[model samples]
Target: MRGKYTIKEINRIPELLKKGKEYKITYDKDKKYTFIGCGSSYNLGLITTKMLNKNGYKSNVISGGEVIVFDKVPQTDIGIFISRTGESTETVKAVENFKKRKIKTIGITCTADTTLTKVCDETYIFEFANEESVVMTGSFVYILNFLLNGIKKIDIIKDAETVLSKIKEQIDTIDLKKYNHYVFLGYEEEYGISKEGALKIQEMAIQNVEYHEPLEYRHGPKSILNEHTLVVINSKDTKKEAKLAEELKNMEAEVILIGKGKDIDIPYNNGYETPLRMILPQYLGYKKALIEGYDPDQPRNLTKSVILD
Candidate 1:
């Protein structure tokens, strides 16, 4: 079966991220930062904020609707608005709100000459990372990699092709039809990634997906686990996390751990390897969608961008 733009965009991630390496983005370490967007862009903000905070920079993530509807703009010196199309109404409006507050605002988008560029103080457009597909894929990694690089120099993994090949091999071995529920768990920046992982499967395959912090799963979420459940842990390679994976496996749930020496062992470099880790779910979602006889590109009742009136 021929996969649509979803698979095509997934394949382009390495090239797009490498192309982003040539560009330089300037940021103020002294300024308080606020990141605003919707959906996938909002999730990117979450990961970015966690990274920034962990590195000693003051930053926070807020949904665009919070700023537009609730006037919930946090007090900050700088604001970064993210949108793939750069025309998302709430996101553009959020940038306006930041500008009205006299905050230095930056708009990050994959498309150029967009409404977002007109509203923000500065815009970083990565046109090469733009996707033909509705669901954000390669462009998501590109923008996140670019923003992370701006804070600190990041080494874009050169072996993305090899990593993806391993993911494909792993996906082929799994009986996707056997699982009806999928759960993704992680910590800090990885938590945001887990959310995105769940969203990928939810969007592409229309599966029952959930995301939570690694340790938080035991609080109440693990009770539903059964042989039909597939759990993906975006581990930090800690002993506790590994133990949780082992425990889940013992409970009859299929577990795929993405970290050092796990099922899909991608080297964990203090969450800097997040973009590469995303490949696993992206591919899994696509393959599962095929199994369910759904077109991954054109998910039911969804559009490329959420443009509100």
Candidate 2:
């Protein structure tokens, strides 16, 4: 438990975000783009894909294993391979699959001088963001911020301090010991972030967690809400999501809303604001793990990268 890299990395997100702009490139709107990765990288791609498609760009995300096992690689002009350590098996292997199709491949990772750099046509390694922990944290923020920088001009680094401060202010008030179940809700990229947020708590806190679109939760998942449920709505600033937050609170479930100053105020700047939405669950997961006497940095049954046999 002496290893506290999770929170340490979480705290560096704002600084890492500043580094993202240096990597921004002009994203061609008409060219079809494909992103591939696993776990948090996949989720990062999911969010970037959402932002891209929503802004008249053609893009899609695929898990690396889907390319290796199911041959599910889609036609694309370029393939972006994501892996934190530059050694995830499926991701590194899947690069050849894209090359075989004559598609240009780009690699993104935190570490340098690894398999991903050698396999891809080019690689963007942010050695500054290389982590000392098993789980990925700041790298997700850095990489997503980098991709978002290409499509949009809003500097997230300017807003990072206020957004993270609000998240910490609200999360500190939460008695994490009282909760056992966590749920994250949103739509589109918010849903992608919800899924990633769920991952943060899942990997670090080792808790029961769920994620769904805000309205979709009522379709079936709401049946499980109890006093121990802590629901976080990555709000769309919609009337329905606001109403849903109230409904869940009435059910005796603690609720945190991250839109328009409800709990953590982040006015959605189109889809660009989605990356900052992750700070809450990241910090919450860290605090939850500490309360449970578990080490957030050293997650059990996990490693920095998944190298398949």
Candidate 3:
């Protein structure tokens, strides 16, 4: 319940995903729309935009507040605002502005009765109390996975389930405390996941963490690595990135390969489940952070969401 969710909690993720599916933009196919996710939710919006684009849906990620107040969003545009608390000043103002114009909006949040939820035409409530700490843990993974499962084609859902299962298995095996610092590396399809993973480590562990694509790491990030630097690399396909892993190992960096890349020893193979699968080692890191006297749920100087006015 603290570090990783129990099996029951994990199984509930699919239902949460299906609920988000009901709000799939059927009416806005021809209309211009944007995704407005604040804070960590912004990262989710990035993943959402990419996935939607892949599935033939046109979308973009912009600050919820920026889209409404600064940018002249078209009247026909729809807003998808994501916040854990639904109380962000910018997000609320953005939703309110849209409401003034009678623009369509959708709110994704944990609280069903928030201002954003009340104003939006539709709402997807994650209802996960994986909160209570400043930094979001289970809630982030849960909501992102929910969105992915919901937006993905129905046929692909089965594959996604397998991937989710694999993530669980990988999480069960990873030894997080073996290394002091982590440098997450990824490229192409897994780049965003690498960034997200790095953020998780920072938020949860508050340790020395960095992320770069494999090529980018070699450019400059490689200089900071040593045997103590746990190198976590995510590739869309591990087999293809094995050579990069080999290079890292040759450099004496402790390498853990994820996604489509495979090489050396540390492996967390849980199939291709996108960001959700990426949650594995991250969850492990959270546990490590917790054991090391840091609260993964509440990192220093962090809040549930920012209220940028």
Give each prediction's root-mean-square deviation over alpha carbons.
1.2, 1.1, 4.4
Mark the 10 consecutive residues where model 3 has the least summed lDDT: 263-272
Candidate 3 per-residue lDDT over residues 143-231, each given as its tens digit? 66666554543323454455566655655565666667888776533566676777777776777888787877778778878877777
* Candidate 1 residue pairs in backbone clash: none
What local distance difference test score does each model get? 0.88, 0.89, 0.64
Q: What's each prediction's TM-score?
A: 0.97, 0.98, 0.77
Ranking by TM-score: 2, 1, 3
Which pairs in model 2 have colliding backbones? none
Sliding window of 10 residues with minimal summed lDDT for model 2: 17-26
lDDT by residue (tens digit), candidate 2, 1-309: 444788789898998887666676568977999999999999989999999999999999999999999877798999999999999999999998999989999999888999999999989989999999887887888788788888877787878888888788888988999999999998899999999999999998899999998999999999999999999999888888899999999999999988886778898677788878888888998889888888888888998899978
**lDDT of each residue in 1-309, candidate 1, tens digit only:** 446788889988877867777888766678899999999999999998999888888999999998988888899998989999999989998887788778999888988999998888889888888887777888877777777887788777576777878898999999999998999999999999999999999988899999999899999999999999999999998999999999999999999998887899787888788888888888999999999999888888888888887
Q: Pick the candidate with the highest TM-score.
A: 2
**lDDT at 60, model 3:** 75
